[model samples]
Target chain A: MSKQAPVIAIDAMGGDHGPEVTVPAALDCLRQYPQLQLILVGQDAVLRESLAAHGRSDHPRLRIHHASEVVAMDDLPSRALRNKRDSSMRVALNLVRDGEADACVSAGNTGALMATARFVLKTIPGIDRPAIIVTLPAANGCTHILDMGANVDCSAEHLYQFAVMGYELVRAVENVDSPRVGLLNIGEEEIKGNEQVKQAARLLSSSYLNFIGYVEGDDIFTGQVDIVVTDGFVGNVALKTIEGLARLLGQALREGFQKNLYARLVGLMALPVLRGFKQRFDPRRYNGATLLGLQGIVIKSHGNADRAAFANAIRMALLEIDKAVPERIGERVATIFANGAGIHEDAPHTTRMNRA
Target chain B: MSKQAPVIAIDAMGGDHGPEVTVPAALDCLRQYPQLQLILVGQDAVLRESLAAHGRSDHPRLRIHHASEVVAMDDLPSRALRNKRDSSMRVALNLVRDGEADACVSAGNTGALMATARFVLKTIPGIDRPAIIVTLPAANGCTHILDMGANVDCSAEHLYQFAVMGYELVRAVENVDSPRVGLLNIGEEEIKGNEQVKQAARLLSSSYLNFIGYVEGDDIFTGQVDIVVTDGFVGNVALKTIEGLARLLGQALREGFQKNLYARLVGLMALPVLRGFKQRFDPRRYNGATLLGLQGIVIKSHGNADRAAFANAIRMALLEIDKAVPERIGERVATIFANGAGIHEDAPHTTRMNRA
Candidate 1:
C-alpha cells in the first residue's frame, strides 16, 4: 500500500438528484477522509455553486472537471455515448483512463455508463466482458453479486467469465481469498432452470473458479456463498425487488408499532435497537457496484442515491484504489485464461495511483 | 346466488401440516359462512382426531370421507394421478365430479394437484388450460397475477385466455368490474420483451379483455392493473422475489425503528398505525391462489400456510362457489374464440384431484 492519497472522480451531473446530492456527499467524503482528493465532473458552474452553498468553496482536496454535455436518463446507451463525448459520464471514465484519478464513480443511467466505460476504457486483457458487482449486506457479512444489470442477455462463456471476475474482485478488495461462487437457478438440482442457467451451471462447474454449485433465489442472503452469479435481467430484478420490499416493510413496521398505546410505549423503548438495525440494513452503506473486468476502476451508484449513498461510493472507490484491486484482478484474470497465461511469469508492474 | 348452499370437498391430508391446518380452517369457514358445507377427505382416524381437537366430534356441517392412498410432495403429477385413485385429493375432486360437492380445494404438492385436477375434474369446454391466480397486495390495493406456477410452457393464446380468466375472477370476487389486464414484460414499450409477450400483446389488444398493453416488473405492485399475466416460470420468480423481499424488508424495518432512544420513542408512537399497516400486507391474508379455467374449483394454499392461511383458502373456495366462478369462466372462454378462431379449443373435463 502506498502513502499517496487516491483521487475519486465523481459524475456530478449523474443521478436523479444530480449535484444537490452528489456535491454534499463529495464534501462529506472529504471531511471523513481528509487525505482524499475529489474531481467533480460536470458543469463547472453547477459544481462551484453547490460547493459554495455547502460552505466549502476553497477546499484544498476538491477540484472540478468541466464536462459540458449531460446524458439524459432515458437516452439510448450507444447513441448517448457516441453523440455526447463531453458528457459527465464519459468525462469521468476518461479521467481514470488518463491517470487523472484513481477511480471514477457515477449514479447515472446504468446502460449509458456501462456502454461509455466499455467503449472508452475497454475490457481488461483476457476479459471478455465487464460485470456490475454489488456487495450485499447479509447476516454473517457482505456477499458480492455480479452482473446486477450489465448484460441482460448473456452466454455461458460470458457468465463463466463473470464468476471468475467476481471471485477475483471479492478476493482482492475484501480479502476473501477463496470466495465461493454460486450460480443462481430456480432450484439447487442440476436438472432445474431455463437453458441459459443450465448452461451457466455446466460452465461454472468446469471452470477453475471456486464454484459452489447451484443455488435458489432465496439462498442469496443466507451467506452460503461469497459470490452469486446470474444474468443482468434476473440480477437487476432481484436487487430492485429487495429495495422495494425494504421500503414497504419499513413503512409497515412503523405503522405496526404505533397501532396502539401499549405498542407505542414498547416502540419507544425499542427505538435505539431498531435504529441500529435499520442502519445495519441501510442500502446507503452498500451503495457502490464495481464495474468488474474493466481495464480501470469504475463504480456505479444508485440512480436515486442521496448524500450518504454518494459518500459511500467515494469511499468504495478509495478502498479499491488502496487495495490495488484493478492490478490484482488483471493479474488473476490474465493468468486464469489461456490467452494471457504465457505472459504471467513476468508479474507486470502494478499501476500506481497518482493524486493531483 | 342459489338458495341452496354449495358443498366444497376438502383434501384434509394435503399440505405440509395437513389435517391440523385444514381441519381448523374448515371449522373456521363453517363458522363464518353458515350456508357452507364441508366434506373433509382423509384418513378416518386422523380426520376424527383433528375434528375432536377442534371441539366438534359430531358437527352437522362437517363430514369425513376416508381415503386409503396418499401422494407424496415430490411425486410426478402424471404417475401420481394414474396410481393414487383412492387418495384424499382424488376423492375430493371425485365428490365434485359426482355432484356431491360444487368445488374442491387443496394445499398439496402444486404440480400433483394441478395434474390431478386436470386429469379428473377437467378443463372447461372452451378453456385450453387452467392458470393459478394469486392476489398480491400493492400500493393502491391488490393486483391479481395469473399462472403463478401452473403451466411452465404456454403460447401467446394461452396468455390471452389467462387475461380473460383473471379479469373475470377479479370482477366476480373482488368486484373490480371492467378490470384492466396487463401482459408482464421486461419493459413498458409494446415492442419490448420476448416473442410470447409481443404476440400475446397483439392478441390481447384485439380481445375484449380491456388490455392495458405491456407492463414492466415494477408495475405489478402499482395497482395500475387488476390482472397481470405471464408464463409460469417468470411469474414464479416474480412471486418468490416479492415474498423474499417482504420478509427481508419486515426484518429491516423492525431493526431501523428501534435503533436509538429518540427513534424508539417515535417507533413506540408509531406502533399501532404500523400494526394496521402490516396486517394489510399480511401474507396469510393473500395466501390462496385459485386454479382457474378448470370445470371444478381448486384452490391451492401456500406451502408454509398456518391455520389462518388455510382458512383463507376455504373462504376463497366459498367465494368461488357462491359466485359460480368456474361456470362464469367457462362461459366467457367459450365465447372468446367463437368466431372460428384458429387456436385450439379442446379443453377436457377430468374432475379429479389426486392428493399428494
Candidate 2:
C-alpha cells in the first residue's frame, strides 16, 4: 500500500501470555498488513527463543528492540515509573514518542501503562488526564465507553472533556460523522444521577456534540448511542460487571445442556448455530483499550488475550495510525476550549459548571 | 399450614400492566400457597370488574379493600407521600401498619413505594432511611443487592447498616446461618474504593456481623457472597446494567437463530434445550425488590412484570412473612446498635457518616 510501512512497537513480555502470544500475534499482523513493520520490545534472549520456537527469524520488516527489565502485572504505577525506567512497556512507549514507531501497543498492567504513557509522551494540550477508551459489542455495532478506571475521581469538567474526546474517537474509527454521545447515569431523566454527572450533562448539552442527554445502564448494550461517558469508578465497575456476567452466562448455557439426554443432543445438534451465536458475542474481537487524550498513540490489550485478540490490538493501533486520530482530537479540543467550552488549564473555579 | 392464613395485600391497580396482570397473578399465588390470603386494593369498581373478568370474585380467602385513587408510575415520591392520601399503594401499606396484613407487595413506582411506606409504616427504630433490596440471579443461587435506588446518597454508617440488614436477610430467606456480607467496590482490596466504601469496610470488619471484606461488581451474580452492599447510585446502575445486558443477550440469540434456514432448523432442534436455558435465566423468577429497613414488609415488583413474574413477587412477600424477616432484622439491628456501635442518632457533625 505504501513504499514505507508504518511501524508498531509492542511490549512483547508484558501480558500473562507474553511472547508466546505476542510473537505469533505480531507475525500474523505483519502478514495481514503488507505495508506494516513491528518492533518487539523485550529481553533480547527471551524474544530470540520465542522467535526460534515459532520457527521464525528477524526479517526486513520485523526487528527486536531489547529492554532488560520486565514490569510485573501488579507493580505499582509509581514503581514502574521511577525504577523500571528501561522496562519493555516504557521502551515501546518511548519509541512512539521519538517518532521511531507510528504507535505503541502493550498488554502490561493498565494502571502502569497509563502512568508510563502519560509520563513519557505527555498528555495533549488542554487535557488534564488520559482516559482508557474500550469498545464493547452492542446490538447494532460497537459502543465505546470511556474513563474506565483511568481517573478514579473526575471533576465535572473532566467528564465533559471525556465526552468531547469520545465523540472524536467514534467519528474517526467508526466513520460516524454524527456519533450519538450519551452520559451514563442512573436514569434517562436529566434530574437523575449525582452532582458531577448532572453538571457534565449540562456542559455536553451546550457543546457542539450530538449529545443525547442521560442514558441508563441498560443503554450500554442497547446500541442506543455510539459512545457513553462516566467517571472512572462507576465505569470500571460497570465494565467488570459485564465481563463477569458474560462468563457466567456462557457457563450457565453449558450447564443447562448437561442436565439431560435431550439437552445434550440439542447441544450437539445446534453446535453450529451456537458457535455463530457465541462468535457474535465474542469478547476477543474487541480487545484493545485506547488511551485517549494522549499526545501519541497507545493501546492496551487484555492481559490474558490470545494470539488473535492480541493481533486485534495491533490492528487497532494501525487504524489509529492510518487516520491520525490523536491529531484530530487535539484539533477538536482546541476548538472546544477556544469557543469557551471551559477554562480548564488555569481557571481554579468551576466556570463551565457555574455557567451550566 | 395454619388454619389462619398469612394475609398479603396487593395493590391491584399498580404496575404497567395494571389489574389485567395483577388479578391472574394473585390467583396463581393463591393456588400455589394454600395458606396465603390476599387483599386486592384499588377503586372498588375496577377491582371488582377485573376480578370478575378473570373468573375470580370475593371469597373467604380472597377479599377487596377499596382505594379510590391509583399512584401513577411517574408520580413524585413527595407528592405521593403528601397528596395521594387515598392511593392504592398507601392503602396497601396501611394494612401492614394496622396489622391487618402480614406484608404488602406493589408493582408501583419505586420512589413512591419507598416514600409512602416510610411515611405510613415508618422505618425501623435505628434506620434513618429504608433501602430497596432486589434478588439478582447468580451462578449458584439468588444474590441479594441493596440500596438499589431508594437512598440516592448514603454515608459510611448507612452502608454499615446495609451490611447488617443484608446479613439478616440471607439468614431469614435463604437459611444461611452466617451470611457472608461484603461491601461492593471497584476492587476486592480494602483500599480499592472511595472514602465512604473504605470507611464502611472498616466499620463492617469491626462489627459483630460475619463480614467478608470487599467485593467487586461481578460478585453480585457470581453467588460468591450472600449479599452485596453499595450506595444507591452504584447499586442501581449495576442492577439495571445487568438487566439491560440480559435483555440484549436474549435478543441477540433470537436474532442469531433467525438469520438463515440452517439456523432456523437448529432453533427447532434445540427448542427444548434452549427453553431450559431460557428458564434457568428467566428474569421473572427474580422479580421481587423488598424495601428493607421498614417496620413492615414492602416488596416492589418490576413495573412491567407479567402474571408469572408478579406471582413470584407475591411468593417473595409470603416467604418474608413466613420467616418474619422484618422482626428478625429488627432484632439484628438492636443487637448491632446495643453493643455501643457509635451514637449515630445525634453527633452534630456528619452524624450518619461520623459514626465510623
Candidate 3:
C-alpha cells in the first residue's frame, strides 16, 4: 500500500451476512478507489476462505486482522463493551484508535458498535457524547440529520454541539460555505417542543451558526435546510419511519404494476423512467451513518446493507478521511467553546469523558 | 332533523380556505348522510353567502351558528384560549359541550383547537389530558397512533392512558375486538428506550389490553400492530415525516411520468393502476384526528384540507358519534382504574385538570 493511502478497518464479522457482504464490499471499494487500503477484521480461517473464493486472497490493498470473538446482533452494549474486547467490532475500532487505520466502517449491532467505538476511540474534546449523523435524500439535493440513536436522552448543550458538528460535517463534506442548520421540533412555532428542544433552540439562535429557527419533520425532505438537529430518540424513530414508508411505497408500486396484464405491459415500458426515479431516492446510495464527535471517523452501515450499500458506507468513510472530519470538528468545537458564543453558562460541565 | 340524528358543529371559518372548503364539505356530508345535521359556525354574513353559493341556504338539516371572532391560524394556544372566546373553533366546541352537537370538527390551528377543546369540554373522568389519535394507511389494513401532538411531555401513566384510549378507539371504530398495542421505541429490545417508555412497557405488560412488546417505527406501516402508542413529540414528527415522504414520492412519481413523451404515454396507459395505488393511501381518506380523552368528540381536520378532506373529517366525527367514542373511552379508563391493573403506584396524583 502507498504510504499516503487512506486505510479503513472493516468489521468483516459484523452485519447479517458477515464476510460475504463486507469482504466483497471492501474489494469493490479497493477497485473503485485504487488508493484505498482496507484491513478486514474477522476470524482468520473464515476471512481466508472468503477471500480465496474471490480469487484475490493476496490482494496488495487488502489484509486480514484476525479477531477471535464476534459480538452477536442481540448483545447488550454493556456486555459487549465488557466481555467482547477481542470481537471484530472492537478490533476494528481499536485499529482506528491505534492509528493503524485512517477510519473504520462497521455494519454491526448499533448499541454494541456505539459502545465499543466510544470505549476504544473516545469522544473529541468539548463534545459531551458522540452522535450518529446520516444523509437523507431530499427534494432539491439531500439533508443531513443527527443523533440517530446514540443517546436516548440529551441536554440542550448536547443538542447545540450536535448542530455545530452537523454543520461542520456538511460544510466539510458537501463543500458548502455555511450550511443552514435547523432544530427538528414538532412545529415551527417558538413554543412547540419540550423543554430540551426549546432550550436548544434558544442556544442555537444565540450562536453564530447559520441557525434557521425550527423545522418540522417534513422540512427534512423539503430540502429547505441542510442539517437537522434532534435528540437520538426522535431522530432514530424518524429515520426508521422513513425507511418503513419507503418500503411500503415500493411494495405498493410493485403491486400496482402487477395488477393486470395491461398494467404489466405499461410497467415494462415505463421501466427506465421508474428506475431513474428509484435511483434518485435509492437507500443504498445513502447508506453510511457517521458516528460523529468521536476521536476518529466511524461509519455504521445498516446491518442488512447489501454490497452496494456497504460500499457506499466505505465511500463515506473515505470522504471523512479525505476531509479530515475529526480534526476539523475538534477545532470547530474548541473555537466555539473558546469564543463562548453558543455555550450556555449553566450548561453542565460534565461530559462523557469525565463521567466515564 | 331526525330525533336520533347526530349533530356536528363545523368551524366554517377555519382552515386555509375557510367556508370555501368547509361549507361545501358540510353540504356534502349532509347530502351523504340523510340523518346527519350540521351547524356551520362562522361570521354570519360570510357563512350565509357561502351557503347561498352552494344552494343550501334553506337546507333543513343544516343551520348557521354565528361566531363573532375568528382565530388566526398562527395564534398562540394561550392567546386563542383567552381572547377568542367566541371564535368559530371555540363556539363549535361549546356546542359540543352544551350537548347541542354530538361532536365538533375543525380544520383550524392545532394548538388553539386543542387548548380551546380542553377548556370547553374538559377531559373525561379518570383521564388526565386529551390526546390526538389518527389512523394511517398500513400494509394489510390501517394502524391507529396517538398522541399525535397534544401532550409533549408524557409520563409512564400518561402513555398507559394513551394506550387504553387508543385501544378503545380502535375497538369501537375499527370493530377490532382486541387491538394489538405496541409502544413506539428506538428499538424492539427491552432496554431500548428511555425510562418513561420502559416503565410504560411494564405498565402495558400488566394491563388487560393486548400489549405487544416494543415496536420500531417501521411497524406502524407493517400492519403488525393495530395501535402504536407514543408521546406527542415523536408521534407528531413521525406522522409529519410520513406525510413528507408520501409527498416526496408522489412528486417523484409525477415527475417520472412526465419526463418524456414516451414516458408520458406509458403513464397515461398506467394511469388506472397508479390511481388505484394512490387511492389506497390517500391522506384525505384518513383526514380526521380525534382529540381522545375529551368529554365530547372533537375531530381536527388538516389545516389545509380541501373539501373532500374536510368532508372526511366530518364523516370521522359522525362515526365517532355513532360509536360514542368519548363515553367508551371514559368507561374504559374507569374500568382500568377500578381494576388497578396498569396504574403506577407512584404515578403523580396531580392530573392536568388540577394543574390547568
- Calculate each model's fnat, 2 decimals: 0.22, 0.62, 0.76
Error of 3 at B241 (Å): 0.9
Instruction: Rank all candidate structures by their lDDT, best first, as comma-separated numbers.
Output: 3, 2, 1
DockQ of 1: 0.28
Ten contiguous residues with the weakest lDDT in model 3 chain B: B347-356
Task: Report how far off residue A117 is in candidate 2 (Å).
Answer: 1.4
- DockQ of the two-chain complex in candidate 3: 0.62
lDDT of 2 by residue, B1-356 (tens): 22347889999889998899999999888887777889999989988999888887766689999999898888888888789899999999888887788789999988888878887776666666778788877887878888888766688989988887878877888987788888887742222688888899899899888888888877877888888898888888888889888998898889878889988887887788788778878989889988998777888999999999999999998888777777777677777677655333522221111111
How far off is residue B19 in model 2, in Å? 0.8
Ranking by DockQ: 3, 2, 1
Give the range where candidate 2 chain A is weakest over 10 consecutive residues by summed lDDT: A347-356
What i-RMS does every model get? 4.4, 2.4, 1.7
CAPRI class of candidate 2: medium
Residue A225 in model 1: lDDT:
83
Where's the lowest-lDDT run of ten residues in candidate 3 chain A?
A: A347-356
Name the lDDT value of residue B66 in candidate 2. Answer: 92
Mark the regions of model 1 whose C-alpha exceeds 4 Å error after superposition. Answer: A2-4, A125-128, A187-191, A254-270, A326-329, A335-356, B76-79, B125-129, B152-155, B186-192, B249-274, B339-347, B350-356
